[model samples]
Target chain A: MVVASRKAAYHHKDGEMTETLVKKNMSASRTSAVPNYRGQQVELGRETVGNVRCANPFMVAENVNVFYGDNHAIKDVTLEIGKKEVIALIGPSGCGKSTFLRCLNRMNDSIESARVTGNISLDGGDIYDKTLDPVVLRARVGMVFQKPNPFPKSIYDNVAYGPRIHGLAGDRAELDDIVHRSLERAGLLKEVKDRLDDPGTSLSGGQQQRLCIARTIAVNPEVILMDEPCSALDPIATARIEDLMDELCEDYAIVIVTHSMQQAARVSRRVAYFHLGYLVEVDDTDKVFTNPHHKLTEDYITGRIG
Target chain B: MPNQMTSRARVEAGLSRRKRKEKIFRASGLLATAIGILFLGIFFSTLVAKGASAFVQTYLLLDVELTAETIAPGGELDLEYADFDGLVRTALRNNFPELSGRNDRRELNRLLSVGAGFQVRDLVVANPDLIGTTQEIWVPAASNVDMLMKGNIDATVDESLRNLSDRQIRWIDTLDQAGRVDLRLNKALFTNGDSREPELAGIRGAMMGSFFMLVVTIALAFPVGVAAAIYLEEFAPKNRWSDLVEVNINNLAAVPSIVFGLLGLAVFINWMGLPRSAPLVGGLVLALLTLPVIIIASRAAIKAVPPSIREAALGLGASKMQVVFHHVMPLAMPGMLTGAIIGMSRALGESAPLLMIGMIAFIVDVPGGFTDPATALPVQIYLWADSPERAFAERTSAAIIVLLAFLLLMNLAAVILRRRMERRW
Candidate 1:
């Protein structure tokens, strides 16, 4: 009885930390949401959207909702993914974390039954706009799936597929360079450089995941969406990928979906907790893990509910 | 441990029971094999017994004096003296001298193939140098003579009932003794092409026509079918209309090939005014027949390519068109080709529809274009099978053998291509 009670007490203490964290992050965002009249007044003469601090907030999703047939897969969720920040979405299965991640690059548009509403913008331009080509949007907003889905092609060809398709490289030599650089960034070049002609599937599961990441990076996307990218990996591989994610955050804005609470806290600069297709709370990673406002977020973080 | 032991015992018991069942199954399998072999044995024996004699042919060797007086007037190579029937009669009289005194020379002439004149004409044309030179020519005899050589005819039958007289039989016997009658195997029967003369007709022209038709079929059906399949399977919106189209495509594959032939006749022949008896028309009809097969196969192949591939391509920023053509098309090509060849093989053997579209025409020259007059092997077989001549029976069987050989070759090529090219993800 004492052990069970002690476990409950530990859960409760964790809950209090999450609550305080949510309050602080939301407060800072609330102030930033308002018009910057004080900055305009301080300006010498010229003022424009560029002069504003929020001019290029990396990614801004406003009232995003997704439906698949009759099921409401995602509710109206509003969030801002700041430049070079690692934002992790933590949720139980089918809670729309992956759905929301796909919406970042309009990947859901490929699904015939899926219908997305509202604006999801990368650097202020609406990504879901009628004029925007999904192909170009996807090139700029790269994605990595849950499973290590390296194409049944050579490692070099796998990484080069994106650059070749988008005509990102100037020539074959340039494409080879892009492939090498991308693989190096993904931390797989050293291991696979000698066997570049080998099939992508010939690699280990963790290596295949990194290969997929390299393939995504070949297009030089400004943002990366990782949907449980490290789930189909071992502890060693997972740790390596997490470290890579931290380094990737310096150059590209990243949104990751993870089931592991520790992974969410360790990797992400900011964390969003989702429950039943709703974004329950969003805050800085440390604060969200330490203190949350929403009761559901508290329950999930403390292992009381999911 | 208890559960493991219990499971192990159960597995052993199950294995014993399975062993017993397998024994029974093997016994029944052997019985089925025996039955199959028995049936096959009967079928093959019947076929060989009935068709074996058809392979052998009889030839009449005649030592004729090729005098310039008979062949050409004024000792010149006159094309006018190339009267085929006159030359054949002169040769026949030279072989059987007893027939020279016979009153019923017309009856004696009937023993020789009515179309023997054509063979003689061909020989003269081929060797205009052979004029005025005495040569022993071994020419094909009539089918009745072939049957006689094979011992299928008896001489001791009733005088009134028999077509040939005892004296004519004596003449044939004397000619056989004098080495003037040559009853050798006829290889020309299989290698030659269609002719009005039953003795000289072969399936060569029809075989080439079928090949050309199948070529056109592959060229036409493969691209259109696979493209349509890719659009339907990968790119097209999955709405009610596409669903309806999918269902309709499935139904079209099941529709009788004859119906497609009728449709081709109406649309390709009457409506488009395509040349009748041309391989082009035949090919078009066959392609229409083959299209649905190829489409269904290609769709299945495209579907067999896992959705993960499409997602991966899309994730990599490849457009929908690129995803289909670059990845899906290569994967689906083998199945499409296999299906196309199978469909074309079926088309090769199709006769009823080709007959309705005037593919049964007795053509001698090889087809030059899609619009050229031609007959397919099966259509040639059909035409020969319908003829009242006794000799046409063997010709029809020979045509079937050729058609079967072509179909087998096509199927083998399909198998080889599929094995070599088809890649499993």
Candidate 2:
């Protein structure tokens, strides 16, 4: 019991050092929230918009910011994602929700003008460390985009893409099993089992999105990030995807960005709300919908302001 | 009621005017398309009418007895030493029994082709038993007689300006009346070499030269252009240096083709010391001329591939190289090939650059290799077009038709490939 208590003390001390570091890095503009806070400057103690830590996190983003040339796209954002949980990021348009989601796997590296600056770690390893490669990092943390961008290939090939590139399968038979298992887990086996050779694009929109989900999990990533996976989909398709996400969170840590307030409450245990480029609030899904702590979060969930 | 009627009449008048304008616009569009088709039809028909005669040429029939005296000097059949030209003159003399003056004999000899002797000689050599017998065979008529037999040279024209003399025309008429003159398909037009005699010239050498040059040009341009396009479009940063490259590439496309010729002359000829009229140098020059065109086209093709595909590949943990090669390039391939076809056709039609590279040498033999002395079809037509012979004009039009056919075939391939490979999504 002494060793455990002392270890907790050491963790708190480390947390204090990180808090001081966060204070030191905050520019003058980030010290206070906007005047919608009744013209009162909120205290900057430990400087968090919401509950930003957990007992053991699968991924941690500390004091992260993103810029595009002169545009500060994301500002001083800090969040931690726990394993076996579905966390939904919710916000108005252009509030850097998708930007932060991409930061998890370094998908922003492909954008020419995007510049991300912060401490981001997966399983306590710095993802931005010069020794780490983004390609391998991405295998550990997969992503699903807004559209069902199934590759211009067969459904089998689409699911097998990650396996082929990383050499996860030793032979064609093994590869087929991974594809079949991934499709089964994505809840698409009943429909697509008979025509695995058909193009992924030949399926309906919902089927195509499920194919993308199957492709992502086939790589066996520890965490999955979906960027508004249901925006282009209909109501029925969106509900199906939400159901898939709930089932998937049993095995993998899931972070999803969505515009719908009800989708966050329905699918995720925790919700993160962003305003402009600022991350405003993060709390339990019930607490955020009923008793948001920040004024911007209240204004947004109440439908008064964004 | 009167005011309502006036307003209704005005609105109806306005509506009728707009509808009439729409119909006029549609009719004008149809008329413009018809005019373009009419011009194409007129051009094609004119070319066919002018060049169809060149496929067949006039020939003269003569009877000759190959005596042992002419075939052999010492009673032994010596085929190599035979006096075939003597036998030809003898046959003409025996047929007409004309005046024996040297001038008259020369005029009669001019009625037959210089190739007539070789025709009789080859026949006799092929069948040695016919040496002591008389046989009637048709050999090519002289170019002037050929023109007269084909009705290309008008007898109504003044005798001074016409290449054929009055007596030569009369002999041709007599031969025609006797059924001794015939128009056989001009196999020589395909089999022979470039000649001072337009009747003997053929495009085989030029066609072969063009084939070699085009092979070299495509081999050099297609890969280099695609690689450069991939580098510029996918990898190059948006900086001043990249901007300069982009500007220069666009500028190079508008640079006159003759400038590329001068560049080839300075670089490939003066500095490199390549053979002047060789298809190798001409092909290299053409490759340089087409590189800019291909690069511009390939860049557009690469650009036309959607960005969502790249994002999808990247989201799947694909490396940048995999994203480009596996997804982007396959999607963009059909467009790249279309661009390549357009650039190559442009190279095929280019004559000025090859001319500047010195492909204007008077070539005789078909190009046996890339480095041999050669001329392309356009250069051949250029050379033939400058000739004083009336027959070369027909050959010039024929070469144009052949060039158009080659371009048409490449365009058809581009269309077929696009249809086969194009994906709707």
Candidate 3:
């Protein structure tokens, strides 16, 4: 009966199941005669709910785990990021969401004691292959930090930093064009075009964050990873960045780690919820919010547990 | 309410006691500062009072007949073998025609400096026509006469106690009355080299030695120190070996500089077979002493650069080398330069290491190259201070003043460079 009920809820398709309905379903499963759901015995944190695979995946991780000197930072996890899609990884603090995000671009290699096991691939290429340089990989998968860190250089140089380093531009005019287009796409050209010579640090916090975004996009990476890019911004700036993610997703896959559920709901097509280093559930944004299949995902979304 | 009132009164009492304690602490700090300033003021005042006399030297004008027979005896205009001292003696005897006895004539001739002959030679060499005519020449007086004229010697004291005898004082008075005695700027103090006669001794030789050593020291230490700091801070693995190196570097910074002097003596002088008393050897020794300081300071400067900058560069696909050279290095350069300047200044004031490398030897000629034999300013000052001559005491203070000035200028440059670099950022 519980399996049938969960199957019914999974195929509900309404996309607007009320919080009471999710709670009623959870309570009914607890009291039901059948002790199984989805043809398996139910467990809160052991198994992930919903689908982990995507229709057209480009970046894939399989049973990936991360350890920092024997401290399990990220547990056995699997997820796929597709081309031209926005995926949000959301969890409470210390849940390893950011760690998992770093794993995609092999950024975890910088940490001395961090050890990653299992497989992660981008476009069927093993990124951890000894022959593949991390420098080249980072150019393909760029990251925006939680804080805006513009170089101690002019706005133009900050935007030109990636292109110059990667030899992406062949000449001065080409570099200038790249910088101009990046700033324009980041929605900062009108504000900073007249003062490209000004130090990037001289900008307002929101503008500096936008300048960092411009810097990231100047390299034209295949995927852009943003780790709580809006956490340091005010609500208006956060809205601006959320709108930018919407527009940016059309050209490249974007993975965002955020603490704001509303942000995940607004920006991402799919939402992955992590709890205690475990990815509890990943599903379509509406399903994860309105009709979560896992008890922990439902409880977390309903403010019952973090 | 009664309990609350007591508690408030107790709090007020404790606050008054804390304020009293703070006042006492502040007064103590002020007192310490005042004491330090007082000592510094006394030191500078004494230095100026003693060293000011060295800037001006006493000269005696003499009408000397530079006979061609005495200067170019063979009519070949020979300058090196000229009897310049005989010409000076004849001029002195002409001035005092009354002194006929051999002892009286000898005492009168002693009034002129031994360098007076060299001065006359230089004048004649510059103007060959002066060799045949009698001309009025202003010659530096002997150190004793200079001391008496500068009031360093007490004429009121008995002849036995004074540096200048009664007869010499009388002669100087007669010259003063005739308007032949004058005080002029001591150009010799800057132009000439060390001499047995105090009036001929100058600091140019030691100054050149110090300059050459400092040049070599900074050239060797700055690049090596900065490179080591970069590697240890940016690329070195955090393991047992790196940890040991870090500890050893910290220890090396605290090592007494004299130990480095000993090491330089054993290595550069004994094993390497480099010439002793050469500025090159002194510079090598000082570089050893300064390297630890520069490395430690450079590491601190490199560490002070925010990690976010490194990450920003790294995130942009910059290689580790590119990140360090293009980003981290530029951001850390101002700090590194400041550290290097400070290290160079410390090396400048360092005399202990140079002393062990035989730089304490009394060198007479200014160093023209790194390998030439030389002495440093501090060693010259030390030698002068140990001299019995009253004039050397003044020169010692003057050398100290020059050293202090250079130190002040270097520190000022460091401050200005730091301010400018920080503003650029």
Ten-residue segment with the worst summed lDDT in candidate 3 chain B? B416-425
**Predictions' DockQ, in order:** 0.47, 0.52, 0.44
Q: Name the best candidate (by DockQ).
A: 2
Where's the lowest-lDDT run of ten residues in candidate 1 chain A?
Answer: A43-52
Per-residue lDDT, model 2, residue B32, is: 100
Over 4 Å off, model 1: A1-56, A234-240, A288-295, A298-306, B1-56, B74-76, B83-92, B102-111, B114-117, B150-187, B362-366
Top candidate by TM-score: 3
Q: What is the descending DockQ order?
A: 2, 1, 3
Tens digit per residue, CA lDDT, model 3, A78-131: 898888899999877888999999888888887888878778999999888899
lDDT of 1: 0.77
The residue-by-residue lDDT of candidate 2 on B1-425, one tens digit each, is 99999999999989989999999999999999999999999999999888888888888778888888888667767868898888887776675675588887888888878888888888987888887888898888888888887788899989998988898777777778889889999887777657778777888888888889989999999999999999999999989999999999999989999999999899999999998888898889888888898899889988988887887778778898998899888888998889888988998888999889888888888889999999998888899999988878887887788788889999999999988988755
Better of 2 and 3 by DockQ: 2
Candidate 1, residue B393: Cα displacement in angstroms equals: 2.9
Runs of candidate 3 exceeding 4 Å displacement: A1-43, A304-306, B1-13, B73-76, B423-425
Question: lDDT tens string, model 1, B234-296?
Answer: 779999999999899889888877888788789988999998888888888888888888899
